[model samples]
Target chain A: MKILVVEDEKQIADFVKKGLTEQGFLVELCDHGDEAMERILDQPYDAIVLDIMLPGRDGLSILKQFRKKGHTTPVILLTARSELDERIEGLNTGADDYLTKPFYVEELTARLHAVLRRSSDEQMSLLQAGDVSVNVLTREVKRRGESVRLTAREFSLLEYLMRSPGRVYTRTQILEHVWGYDFDPNTNLVDVHIQRLRKKVSPDKENPVIETIRGVGYRVCKDGAE
Target chain B: MTPRSFRTRVLLVSVAVSGLVLLGFAWWSWQLLEAFSSLSGLDTELVAGHAWLASHLDAVRWFRREFLFLFALGLVCVLGGSWLLAWYAVRPVDLLIDAAEGITAQDLERRIPQRGAGDEFGRLIDVFNDMLERLEVSFNHATRFSADAAHELKTPLTILQGQLDQALQEAPDGSPLQQNLGRLLEEVQRLKVIIRRLLLLSLADAGRIRVALTPMRLDELLGQVIEDVEILAPELRVIQELEEDAWVDADEALLQQAIQNLVNNAIKYNIDGGKIRFQLFRHEENLRFAIANTSEGIPEEDRRQVFRRFYRADPAHSRKVDGVGLGLSLAREIVRAHQGKLWLADAPEGWVMFVMELPEGAGDGAVESGE
Candidate 1:
């Protein structure tokens, strides 16, 4: 899948492009909204991660232009503003999904996957990784054909991690995905819950299906036994 | 009569009385001259003795001139004395009027002095000075609030940019950069929350936050708050004593925001495994909702200031809980806008309790707004 990242800041733009590329997706970067518009007009991208604050043209205007041109490609808006009004404005302006900036790449990746999956023709109700399976429709989980009980929070965390296999997610990303808009990363809730999910979903707790990419984050290996 | 404003009333009365006296004296002098000329017997006798009268005419004329001169001198003395007395009586007040006109919002430091004689103008000056003092304090508070909001927003943005710059120092592989990028995103969201809240407050300050009043059940509102907080902090136990069918006239959205702020604060400040108790009740023409939680009791001095903008009781100033001190202020504003009162009550057992009271039938949009 080809993705376009429209952000003004060189560092953030490069980071997003490089990260998605390593995940084996074709990536394109533009420094401003106008540049993004010119590039997107020529090449059809699978998705676009657009930042709200951009030079030449703001992301909102660009999003409107794309929608005006009848492009229905999925667009996730990144903003540093967390107000309800701003969220409403972004969604009202044809943004498919909204994520506040300073967000974890993992949650961004996960939300993008979810948005893409949701936009796809057929709703794939099950998200599977190795021996564990998640029922997206029913919000249930099972491992080795045995039912495993998980809290509402645990289910959300597992679903977020399982969506993107072999991709590392930081504690902050996990917190944002599992806990709504009000999580304080200073707390140890992320680590505590990761341990709980390990007990429920991993075949052997010692040799868990979820791998901890130390000093980085946790990831579910795609090659693990399914 | 009732020790009325002497400077205003006395000055008006004096001008009216002086004008009437001058008009009355002029009319009386004219009446006397007409009566003397109309004395028929005296006029005929004076003409008959014209030769004798001519001999004394010069002396009579000299006496007449002397009498007129004396009368003119007396009138001048009386008018001049009254004018000086009136000016003396009203001079202090004229000084005060000039001073009052000079006072403005930007220069609240100007004061009318009680000039030590302890007169009425002095009392007015004292009151005016007190008002200015209060105005200066509130103005400073508002300025500080905006400055603090800017600082809060900038700090997180700086961190996010710094992290991204360092992570992508090389040609980005995306994995190592993604991890740092993720942290940066979280901070940005936090910054956004603070900004949104600050904007909410500013809109409210501008008197532009339109609250849509609708009939709402307090029970459902409190239930939502408890359930949301429980999901966020599962370790805490929350108990609700909501009166069912407790209908209230309010803007459902603003009321919800106020209640959420109260509940969120209680959840954030409470001890681990602590219990939160929420109650909604109606008492004699007022609807009251309160939230109580186990907490380190605020100092007596701090309690009064907890609702102040950007105020935090924690001395360490850690950004852990993400408070810009705008929540309580916003809650207070919302409650006040609903024609209600918001306050923190002193609690026993070192607990903190926040109470909000709304006047019955207040938000029917019929209540006269002080705005």
Candidate 2:
């Protein structure tokens, strides 16, 4: 997949670009909105991570212009502000997703994947964790190329966990992402689901694919070899 | 009139009138003595004696005794009257001096009572009172404004420093610098918010708060907001319980701005990917909009001050959220201008809920008065 990162800070942009490239994604870095706009218009990008702050034209204006011109490619906004109103404005201005700065690179990569997968009509989407692959198109799970049976909700939760590896996912984030806004008020639903999923996916292993963060949330390591 | 003041004025006027009468009497007595000496019948010797009073003691004895006695009596009366006059004049002046001397910065509540003299002294007292009134007003506004501003500025500046320090201490040089840059940007954003709020409040105070009240549906506005924020953090569950077709008469831009602020506050202070429960319903004579997010409950003491300009409950949240603490304040002001009320309520599950109630036709006209 090809991604364009438009950020003003050269170092951050370079760091993000190098990380994504190492993860097998073609990455292009641009500092200004004008340059990013030119590249976006000329070439098709699978995803575009747009920073809200730029020198010439701000990210919001760029997003607006792109939306006006009917460019519907998935756009992730990297904003220094975690303000609710600014985030709302960014999203209303046609950004597909928004991330606050001081974020983990791995987290950004996961969100980028989620946004792209949801926005695009492509099937055969696969997210890999340690010795595990969760397929979106087939709704199937494979551990070391062995097929595993999982419930629908289990598969959905596993997919979310697999997308972002070595990053913490709070209980609230898990609740919102998995059960959405309307869910039962059980405190241990997440723990129960994780245990059930582990039973099916990581049999005969002391440490499972999902690792519990004490007093916090859950994490899975990147690079299935681990 | 107090009996003392009236008695003092009466005594002063009476004493001056008596002193003038005494002087007239003294002059009359001397004239009478001269006329008696000038009488024609067998008065040649007497007239000569009176004219040469120093030469003939027998002829001038009667004249000297009677006229001298009368002159002494008049002199005594004049002295007594003048003493009374001076006493009355100086008494009020002394009172004024004592009152003025007692006034100080610590006790602004003191007021000079109009002592019923109804003279220039009374007018002076009134002027002094008016001066104190103006001083109190300006002093209040200036102090409150500075306190709020200082509090607002300090948070962002402190945040910027904290983030930079954390970066230096914890993360690698490159990663932490990036984080520091992010925090610096946040501080700048907070400064902008504070300035905007301050300007708006001043404009409101100056009676220049202009409003373009329009008919707008609350549901649609919130729906758009939900749609927008959902894209920003798809992981966050924002449930909207908007009453459809609920209309309000308000300044369209300002109302939207207020809602945006409240939602932003909710999102910023909320736990990561926490549930944001939004509700819109009409209460008696007002439309209510409420947003609740799971938060560490605000202290009771801080609850009242939360709407005060530049007030923050937690330093960590204040630093991370990048707000200058004016969002809620501005929102409260806008609501008040619209003849509405804004308040914070304790929510279930240790959440903080911000509730805004807007009257149907508030701010349709200019806000009646600021205070």
Candidate 3:
């Protein structure tokens, strides 16, 4: 995937470029807001990471301009402003997703894939990691050719993890995506649900597919190893 | 004393003085007329005769009519003059009232225009303008502080979190460094939450938080919130008695935040396996929402303080809960911004209920949805 990251802060921009490049994505960086807009108008990229505070032009106006020209490239907003109205404004202005600063890079990649997947014409009706597969249209889960029953939340959580196998998701990210907005960050709700999902999908403890990234969040094993 | 009463007293005194003057003039005129008739040299016996008596009575009637006309004219003049004086005296106060009505949280720079120096109205205007100046300064200071604090704390925190994430990614799996980094990241996340909430509170205090109101279905919003609670705490039993098509003109996101905060609190502070009852219905001109949960009820004294920032009821019990005690305060602030009222309602048995009342007719113009 080709991605453009427009951030004024060089260090943060370098970090993001390096991370996305390491994730097997073709990454390009632009710092100035006007140049970024020119690049976006000039080229077609899979996704763009646009920062809100920029010289020449701010992120919101650029976004407005991009949408005004009818560019449909998926854009994720990077904002340092934690105000609720700003977030709402970003989303309302045709942003595919938004991440407040001090966010995890893994979260950025996951959101990128989610947005790209959402915008792509050929939607992956089924998400699979090894023997575990979930049918998106039918809301069905199967493990090793055997049917598995999951709750509504469990299904959504599994679907999210399976969408990007081996990618780490912070508890906050998972809670925001699976649960609705305004969840208590201190609750053990995510852990408990992940535990339930693990039990239901992988009854054999010795060969579990879901790997718990200690001190981080949960992830689906890339190889589905025992 | 009130200015109104003072004006009333002045009017009464004016009327009494005018009446006394009129009575004195009537008495003097009566004496003069008696002497004038004696000077006319009419015989006492002739004056007592029927024709003379009729003429004398006619003259007295004419005098009485002239006296009554003069007295009425004097009374009207006195009353009208007093009324005009009262109105003029209260003109400054009326101006002050108009100025006060225009002052709101959004516009604290408004001041009562000072007339001049040394007089009562002038002094009042000076004091009022001084107070407004101080208020505007403090309000600006607070607003700037919140914005600055958010910027100062969030930027560095973001950098710290990003660096920590990068370090964790490079560290070997299950290594001591990774574990330590994880702990640090958790602390960062917690700090981020605290910072975000603090910013929200400060914005609310400064009245800088803007609410974009739209018509929304209250029932649907409640259902979504309840569903979230169930997902988060599936063990707890939740019952919803939502009124059909309950609508409100609200900032949907903010209102949802408040409702979600209340539901989350009910779940967190609830007894193990406690039941939560959610109800919503229109009460007269208000749309009311009530959420009750089984818990060790808060004492009446603490209930008043619960809505205060950072005031936790039963701190020991709340130690296990995951908030900084701003949820209720923020919730109340949001409701207040919407011109609504939030209160702790009386509950039955061991249940503690919180009720929110939003004024009706706000959603009257909103498009109605069948579902």
> Judged by lDDT, which candidate is best?
3
**Tens-digit lDDT track of model 1 for B61-148:** 4644565565566567656656676677777767777787887654656777667767776777688778878887886567457645
lDDT-wise, the better of 2 and 3 is 3
Please list, in the order the candidates appear, how each scores on TM-score for chain B only.
0.54, 0.51, 0.79
Q: List pairs with backbone clashes in candidate 3.
A: A102-B158
Q: Candidate 2 falls in which docking quality class?
A: incorrect
The DockQ assigned to candidate 1 is: 0.14
TM-score of each: 0.60, 0.39, 0.78
For model 3, what is the alpha-carbon lDDT of residue A155? 93
Clashes of each: 10, 0, 1
The predictions' CA RMSDs to the true structure, in order, are 10.4, 16.6, 6.2
TM-score of chain B of 1: 0.54
- Clashing pairs for predicted structure model 2, backbone only: none
DockQ of each: 0.14, 0.03, 0.30
Q: Write candidate 2's Cα lDDT for B1-371 as tens digits.
A: 65467657766676678877877877876776666545633466765566555355455457556777766777677667666766765666667667777876445557777788678878888888898888767755764574356444543443443334233323332354544544453344345445556756654553344454566677777876675456444567888788777777766667777777777677666777687888989898778888888776777788889888778777676654435666677877788777788898767867989888887534324443211
**Candidate No. with top DockQ:** 3
**How should the candidates be ordered by DockQ, best one leading?**
3, 1, 2
Q: On TM-score, who's better, 1 or 3?
A: 3
State the lDDT at A81 in candidate 2: 37
Show pairs that collide, candidate 1. Answer: A19-B174, A82-B192, A101-B185, A102-B184, A102-B185, A102-B186, A103-B185, A103-B186, A104-B182, B114-B122
Q: In model 1, which runs have C-alpha deviations exceeding 4 angstroms?
A: A81-85, A122-125, A144-151, A170-172, A181-188, A191-221, A224-226, B1-276, B280-289, B294-296, B309-342, B356-371
